[model samples]
Target chain A: MTVDVGICSTDHVNAEVYAALLSELPDANLVGISGESRERVRKQANSVGAAAMSHQELMDAADGVVICSTNAAHKALVDLALRNDVAFLCEKPLATSLATAREIRDRCAESDVVAGMAMPIRYSRPMRRLKEQYEAGAVGELIAVSGVNRGRMPGGWFVDPEQAGGGAVADHTDHIVDIVRWITGEEIEEVYAETTTRFYDIPVEDVNLLSMTLSNGASFIMDGSWSTPQKNSFWGDADVELVGTEETLAADCFGYRYDHVSDTGHGRHTESIYWGADPNNALLRDFVAAIRGESTLAAAATVDDAVRTAAVIEAAYESVERGEPVDVDR
Target chain B: MRQIVAVGPETAVRAHVERYDRFDDAAIAGLVGVSEACADGIGAPRYESVSDALRETDADGVDVCGPGAVHGDALREALDAGVPARCDPPFALDGDAFDGLVSLASDGEGWLTAYSPHRFSRLYDRLRTDVDAGAIGSIGVARIKRTAPFDGAGWNSSYAGISAAADPVDALCAVLAHDADVLEWTFGAVERVFARARSGGRYDHVHAMFAFREGGRATIETTWSDEWTPEPRVDVEYSGNQGRLHFDEHDTLTALRNGGDHGQVAPPGDDCRGGALRAFLERIEGEERPPSAVDPEGPSRAVVAVRRSVAEGRPVTLTEEGSR
Candidate 1:
């Protein structure tokens, strides 16, 4: 069935959603654009050739929707989408707070709607190869992994505590946490985190180190800090190295790049242009395939994964507060 | 020039002798085998014991290139005689031996240090300089990874202390001294450790996390894999509040800016290939060299803590004195 997809909210994430949808699903109809601001919605709708509509109207009319709103607004939008029996794809975090995330997850379970969470990292070429290699026994029984997902602190609503939820720990922690679990086929059993606010004066922490133990007794420590520079630098990274009984393997999804230094954009800056396959394209392709009932979303994250990772992230915050290790809420 | 006696098995002493070929200020004077009787140790006069070798030869320093088992005794024999000596990693097999050697080294007229190709490599020398100068700022996390081909036969035969008879986990911990030494030199003493190890058929892989006394943390992963490689993987990464520093070899260092740009590399340097023997001789010759090998006291304690952590299946805390 050809699906009519509407995008709800064109706030911070609206551009990527529009670009990715068109790049991956060229023939798919973008029927509606909805947001809190009518003017912004109208402008984005015109730009993307989508019709501006209310969130309720968009949900009722379109077969599915993509919510790129701020972190806190996810649950409400998801509730509306589920009530209309409209399938939807939510961004990185399902919701801001764990309580809100759990409520959204439960609501998702009760509905027959096709829901997906945007964890595009697993779709990267290097990460996909890393997972395939592990499953192919490239390394024997994997015992430990050390991963880093460091990014520049994106200012604006991302730094806003209520809008983006937490700081670096929240924003940066999700990608590698999702990768580690997805690649290794193991759930994080516990987490011990030490967090600090550095590089950015935002109300949230920009640096965080989390030592996590996997369900199979293997362990990994992820340095998921938003420590990159926003200007004159490559955006961020998702790199991991795993050790197993027979061998060791490493992958950097964003590592293959052409380093260029020139008096360009920001005046005398060095940045790497990553020539790797765009992960967002792959993620949206899988989401669209699942929405059209053509295939299951093996390449994209489902709503349940969002809840589990939220539990880990929530426990990490708790562990930092308690100054000790905390059991991941399963 | 300094003449050091290579004390160990033929294979072990030859490893030290080979390093001497690259040094200008040092030469292997003689050899003393630990267990088996060895003839002409690669043209150097072979002796029965450390005392006998020192008693007969004009050797001024001792190089305990023996297995982990005899490192404590051979290095002790020289240091106690007020002779500057260097030994292969672990320095000692057990806590008592380690404590004894540390005490003697502190009081000895001649200095003592451990021998490692990596620590003495031009690679780490420059990195150590950068780290000491805070080029990357105050680092909160440092990760070190080492992987080499597991020499199963040689480990069982020559390395007695770390032979399969010992607890495999402890044996592996004993071998991780070089990695621990790097951490100790860069960061200060580790206050606590949480270690986990796995054995396929041989206990050859382990992951150990350290909480530094100087307000930082580190993860050290060492693996002796079944696959063969021309060179071992040596990855050292330091994540600081300001910037990050990472390197795997002597030629280049990928320096990340305060807001990290991963592709940045420091300019290549003049081939500054300093060896352990050269470092020891420089200290004996009193040249006031920059950044010699650190005291093995901290690394020894870390090994002990890692062993205990693996044994207890929990995190082990190290006190100022030792493992608590």
Candidate 2:
């Protein structure tokens, strides 16, 4: 059966990436797109060969809607889906703050509509293999978990504090945090982060270094920064490493690449190109499969998972403000 | 005798391919670079990448090439297989990993050593001689600037693997680590450090100022831009209370001092890497241990301190008493 997927917005990695992913999945159809901007939504819908829709109309027509708006705008769309009884998939962080994230997750739990967090990196083949190995005791009891999710600064509502909720720390940290939580099944309990605006001139921070403690007492450090320059960086990265008593497991979703050297008559310069299958395709495939009650290829994160990540990020921001370690307060 | 294999990405072990015939004792045989395309070089490709291949690979001795991040695990696998191993600079990042390797090496069956080909080079050998001869007496400050016009460090993720190459520490491990070794080797142990790193994408520029425990200071600046040069251009200058000494990539050394007499000699440019490899093999054979082949704990400590200084936006005491 075809899974009719409607996009809620078309900005940055949401509308464009989802359309590209849907184009690859035969069972998933681009039914419609709903956004605050009618013209923009119509433009995106035309590009993807789908209908332009309002918030409620998209929910009424499609089987599920992807919350692709800015971070702060996620709660409203999720609330709309909760009331409409429409299955919804949300891009990471769940919401801008812990309170809102908890509210959305609590409401979704009370309802019957399917709610999933769009952590596409969970589908990376290397990470999936590592996770399986960890589960099978390839690595003994976990000693520590460290990760990095460095990316090119995506200019949009993401740079705006109000619209995006937070800055580079939240934007990049949540992805790795979710993956760590998934692999270890332990929530991050304490957070101490050092964040600064080193890359861009925007108000929100771009460089983040965090030290966290998991419920199992394993330590975690993350370099979640907008340090990838648009001109030179090969691609964004989502890397995680788990150290156990016996072994250390590491995987980088966007790590496979080769250097491409070409002269454009300017000078001898080298460009790094990513060489691997896109994980976004697998993420959307599993989301569609979960919606259809099929065996999911990559299990989509639930609302509770997203809330846990949000709690860690919220505590991280507090750690940055207070200049010390703070409890995650989950 | 058994041949020692160089296992890592192609470019990292490329020097081994060209100078393979020069080694008298050790033969560069199987699994040179980890890539499939690099199989036809000096050694035949036996395994794919560094993932689990070293756990039980067939080699009497191994050279762990590529980034400094994976050095610990890779070395562990080699030693665990009862194969003596040597690694490229900045041996390992974590103190625990370094200490673990030391403990494993202490077990006696398979030994681990650091690879500093330059230490075996005539150029650095003479540089050390000049320092010993007090050519630049009572050195007050030292500076090294490296500008790589043609080094493909930007796309290092190609061969070094994702786990090794693509972080802000990429330059720190590959570029600055080489210089940090020289800086620490030339000066005494580092007591404190302050560093500032600005990433144009993946941390292409790095600057760090160091204060040595023996009452001297030094500064290091390195840039890995897209400008193409086959070899990285490194310029070193030492300013002293008595005189100054300077050197560049051209194999020429300049020295000047207060009391008049100063001697100049050209350092060896080519054919030294093979000698370095031969010496490393001898060390593996239980001959005299090679210089710069220890735990390299000082450089590792400096790297950790540099990272902390960058994160905290302040100076960090590297060798503080009772500090990890």
Query: Where does model 2 exceed 4 Å of error?
Result: A258-275, A295-298, B1-324
Fnat, model 2, is 0.00
TM-score of model 1 relative to the true fold?
0.82
Per-residue lDDT for B37-117 in model 1, tens only?
454436778777787888888887887663343456677778778777766466664567766777776766656766443
Looking at model 1, give its docking quality level.
incorrect
Q: Which residue window of length 10 is worst by lDDT in model 1 chain A?
A: A15-24
Q: Model 1 interface RMSD, in angstroms?
A: 3.3
- Worst 10-residue lDDT window, candidate 2 chain B: B153-162
Per-residue alpha-carbon lDDT of model 2 for A33-111, expressed as tens digits? Answer: 8888888888878887889988888888878778888888888889888888788788877788889988888888799
lDDT of each residue in A138-246, candidate 1, tens digit only = 8788777888887777777888889988887778777888888899999999887767664556788776778778998777778777765455368778899887766
